[model samples]
Target: MTVPERPVRVLVCDDQALVRAGYATIFAGYGFDVVGEAPDGTAAVRLARELQPDVVVMDVHMPGIDGIEATRLLAGPDAATPAKVLVVTTFHTDENVYEALRAGASGFLLKDATPDQLVEGVRTVAAGESLISPSVTRQLIGRYATRLRPSAPAPADDGPLAVLTPREREALTLIARGLSNAEIAAELVVSRETVKTYVSRILTKLDLRDRVQAVVLAYRLGLVSADG
Candidate 1:
């Protein structure tokens, strides 16, 4: 419901021309500034650098470079000023979901999602929130993440999150379970602002980039399992 204060700058990338035009139009309709469009990851990366859009709508599979690689170039830890990337993937390439997340995607959007969902996906990531509003998509990220993660195990109780307070830890567990801040607020009988504070503190303590990273860390540490 809340749009960005200014026009959210966006870059749309897909190998298909029609898909590119359609998404650009949709984003433009919603008052987003479609700064540039790219047909492949190489162009996406280049245009993103040249344009400095607030968010990049990236397709997973492309002819050159690909979305995962582009995401890394744009949003990876080494990026001096990382751009927020919303990766668009499909069920068939579910494994790429984890790869994209690992490559520093700010969020995930399934290819099958409708136009409205697609728009919201960009908005969500641009607002610095993960696009896990699609609960099923969030669950799938956890499921695929479990499969793609390495065999090495981590301590369930005392890894990077050992520094968190008890309530913050509980909130993070709920986050890994795909609960939004609003949902977690209701669950904890606290206000949404309070939940936001808790999430901020948790991210600060763990030195994480965003909720997507937090979710991945949770799955890796076995704090929340794929089955759940």
Candidate 2:
């Protein structure tokens, strides 16, 4: 018999009690475990370190450390055992979204997102996938690609890109352009399974955690242009 998966454990953090309650209710209804709740980033971090939830639904504007700093502490490069963070906020501007991503947020969602979207966002992050709203992908990453470049000069010779085959490069480009696996399959005239394999190989070769990191790397490495 096939084994069933465990319910995703989630921690909800928001200054508004109503918002936290609403998200907790939705997650519970979806069979997720609402492990804890926090009204501020400091508490959020403390609870996250304590509970070690699979996913953290974080808000950006909370007082006392705010979400960005909290995310960095919980999920950033220096984190001892990073938790996946899905940043939910009212703002959709490039700066806010980009900063959250830089702080190691696994995903970004708007507070106005539908219940279905919120549930899916939590599941996505918990499953080690990343979700950025399509609008944020287009508006923030596509429009502001140059801003994503690093201050240091890029290597002159073949670097990480050299590891990927041509087809993997093509797949990476489409992923950077915000195409889903199914969409990429259709675009490349291949089966979805084939696309999945390519994506898996790409991620392994590039040592990327998920599509979010891949998208950011593509931009930083100039694999995908800002215009298209």
Candidate 3:
């Protein structure tokens, strides 16, 4: 007999007890292992470090360190072994979303998200995928793209753009434009599998964690303009 795969380990962090309980129930119902819960950022960070969960469902406005700082501690560039963080907050402002991404969150979602959305968000992050909500993708990234800067200087000869071939660069641009793999395939007259391959290659060459990071890098490096 084949052994079943392990469930995704998740840590839920929120200030509201009711909210925490709701998420725990939902996660458990969906076969996710609800490993821990925290009412504040400090506790969240402590638990995350100790448990090393696959995904952390973080709240942005918690007391003490808050989700942004806690995310930084767990997933930021300085983190030794970064865990994927999915920020869930009632606030949908551009600043909050941008700050959370800068802190190394793999994705952002509104607390008002449906149960399906929430469950999928957790699973997506656990699977090493980014989960920026569609609404956030359309509004926040467009409004805040100008505020992002490349993490490192581009080299004169080729720079970060050099690592990607022309087709890969095109795929990255389409990703920045928020096109799904299918949409990209339609646009380029290529197979969906081809588009998927291009996306994977782009991520690998850039050393990016997911598509969300790729979007950020695209804007920061002027691969796609903020106006578009």
Candidate 4:
């Protein structure tokens, strides 16, 4: 069997010892290079700056600094190199999820995810794609809908995405709601294949790398408000 080359470097951060150990073992099994492990957000940030890992698997609720804040510091708008952050947390509706996303996290994953899912999440983020659990994404839209700040100015590239048709916008909103292609098709009365095509177009028009980036843009551009 051909072994997959080790190209992705990862930093694991969590307050609990077992969580870190579990992640280290799981990720290592997939041929990822576990560069370092941190027990809190403060250390996570410092280590990220020092190690320059390809991806940071951050926990939302750490003792000091917190994963959201650390993610912002490392991947936020002002970050120097901005390693990709993939939040792994236990609370599905934690307030930190939004903060992390706004802080430029590439994706979010629940701690209860299957081992296979965990491996996939790391690989997805390392490959420059975003992955958010469907359940959590829906919860995020509902929880933050009332708090969304649509008045925020759109980024420069935002206008270019206006090329999407009205239907496409609908698809985008549902995507932000964390609906899968089948779910979206059911809601829109379209075929699953159609939803897939729309998703592809949306990603292309917005120049997004994947669904995760699309979610970030949807929020930043006020297409899907926190209140929506």
Q: List the residue pairs that clash in candidate 4.
A: 144-226, 145-226, 145-227, 146-227, 148-226
For candidate 4, report its TM-score: 0.72
Per model, how many backbone clashes are there?
0, 0, 0, 5
Which number leads on TM-score? Answer: 2
Which tens-of-lDDT digit does each residue in 69-137 have in candidate 1?
Answer: 999999998998889999886654556766777789998777788889988888888878787536346
- What ranges in model 3 sit over 4 Å off? 1-3, 150-158, 189-193
Root-mean-square deviation of each candidate, in angstroms? Answer: 3.0, 2.1, 2.6, 4.8
Choose the strongest candidate by lDDT: 3
What's the ranking of the predictions by lDDT, best on top? 3, 2, 1, 4
CA lDDT scores, all candidates in order: 0.85, 0.87, 0.88, 0.81
| Tens digit per residue, CA lDDT, model 4, 1-228 | 999686689999999999999999988888889999999999999999999998999999999798999999998878977789899998877576667677888888888899899888888788766788755745464444435535655653357557888899899888886777789999999999898889889988877656766866676666665655
For model 4 the local lDDT of residue 91 reads 84
Q: Cα lDDT of model 3 overall?
A: 0.88
Measured against the true structure, the TM-scores of the candidates, in listed sequence, are 0.89, 0.91, 0.90, 0.72
Worst 10 residues of 1 by lDDT: 131-140
